[model samples]
Target: MAAVLSVYLDLALGLVVTFLLLSLLVSGINEAVVRLLSIRSKFLWAYLRDTMDGAGPHGSWLPTRVVDVFRTMPFLRDPRPAHEARPAPASAGEVPETGTGASMINLLYERVREIDHGKQGRTSIAEIPPARFAVAVMELAAANGDVEGLLARLKQMGSPLYGHLKGVWESAQGDLDRFRKGVESWFDGEMERLSMLYKRYAKWVLAVLGVAVTLLFSMDGLEYAKTLLRDDAFRASVTAVAGSGQGAYDELKARCTGAGDPVTCVTETLSEPALVKLMGQALVSVSLPADGEPEVRWNGGAWWDRVSTPSHWPGFVLTSVALLFGAPFWWDVLRRIAGLRSRR
Candidate 1:
């Protein structure tokens, strides 16, 4: 029983470590994709437009004006006047401050055009504090901090937003500060929901990326596992690395948590030459096949057929599915297995 348990623990540890490494690689790639596309900023922009749209009986003119204020938010604007600011496109035309509905709609069009052509970093703001967001909206809705005017305008718009603000205003007993706080709290709730929505999107990204990585590396999880179970030396080496206490996952986690932005931290950390060299050396030490040998090889028959052959399909699917569990999950499993093995 004791010998059987030891073998099982070694197998579990080896599998967990393999999954963990693959997950880290995929995660780094995923983070790069998310950052490159600026998905967070896109969602934020869409949410603000929809929230301000009001969908009232009023024409698009009113909603357009409200949405235009979004670009002027302090967070979105660059303070540097001398940074060679690009002029808004000529086609957009100059919007006159006529205070007429027609002029307001035109101004909204201008804002949209500018945003579409805006310099990348200047237009993409992924985060906005709840308080600042609430304050900006309140200022836009109410001219000169006039509560009555704000209420009148919102009510005139006939949107659900008006009712939402009215409830907050009443709860504050007409105190401007309290009303601002209420709005901020509401923004927080909306952001929480937005976060969940983003997570769902991220899961889809992970699934696609997982399949891509499995294909690129020709990673065969089942074949690798079978090899590890049968080869005493390979299994021992892999298990020893898992039991080393200090691991790539733990180190990456620590460095990323300390940085201002986790995504950027990960990108930089994984790009370090020393870290990459170390990882490469470790893999080589265990005689881990660098380009998918002993299972799938590059030179065998047609390249596509080599990977797509039915025997390799199960391994490919298993590897991709394991990746969806993510690095952190496998890291925890590795740690627990190592701890159990140590106890005996």
Candidate 2:
């Protein structure tokens, strides 16, 4: 019984170890796949943002439209001189002091319209011909391709257009830099946040799967124990102990008593098909008899007495230990097989 139990115990232990290994393998494979796919922080953030912000092809444009409005029309402008200039004449409810490059462009277009109207009327300003002045200014601005130098030249010419142009240019440069830095920082932060979230999600999924596998194996182990306890040979062995009070030895002695030499009698009893079958069955069962079953006993001075030793208690303990450790490993092996098949 001990030998049989030792074998079963070995099997169970192997199975538990196999299960642990399989779990590790599954987790490693999942992580490797994720890494290989490059499904990291940046990708997660972009996916989430596009999904939530409705910027993708199938998405609504409402959020983006609102954001565009806010970006184009900030509530406050910088108090610096660059942002406090304008070319457009002050109108009702208009701040006369503050204008931007966009305002200057608007002013230029308005002036051109006025010149064209005057020319049609045959009363064009000859000293500062509008077309010539516009062309010359455009050429000068393009010559150096330096926006600040062009604004300075315009300022020397002392037009509201100069101040407006300079203010708009300077403000745009600072605002552009600030906006760029803010976008970069936000992108970086979002990536980090998404990376951590994914890691936690993966960890939780792995943990849950591991626990589920363990529970399944535990149930299997319990079923195995039940099967072992219910074997026919096990039932018969237990009954023999209760009836004869000496288990297999008592039965053997009773059968051997009148069969000539004591050694021959013992051998003949052991060789009986039924007894051999019982021993074989006992070896496999390995479970203890149910509670209240009689203890095994043998003749006071016989070798059989030494062999009985109360009951098959040791076998039961060893078997239990083997199964306790082996079930998880066996479950793991089964899981690995399943995983391999799935991959295929």
Measured on C-alpha atoms, candidate 1 has an lDDT of 0.58
Worst 10 residues of 2 by lDDT: 75-84
lDDT of 2 by residue, 97-215 (tens): 33232223222233233333222122222122323334433444454354555566455544444544454455557453443344344445545665565555555445544444333
Rate residue 72 of model 2 by lDDT: 20
What does the lDDT read for residue 4 in candidate 1? 68
Candidate 2 residue 117 Cα shift, in angstroms, is 60
Expressed as tens digits, the lDDT of each residue in 1-344 for candidate 1 is 88667767766777788789889999999888666655566556555544543322332221123233233322343221111235434333332222234222222333333233334533555556787667555554444246666556545544345577788889989788898999999889988987776676668778888988777666777766665554443334334546874443454454456688866655554444332322232212222333664332233344356376799899889989999999989987887877744333
Instruction: List pairs with backbone clashes in candidate 1.
Output: none
Residue pairs in collision within model 2: 12-326, 13-326, 15-329, 15-330, 16-328, 16-329, 16-330, 17-329, 19-332, 82-167
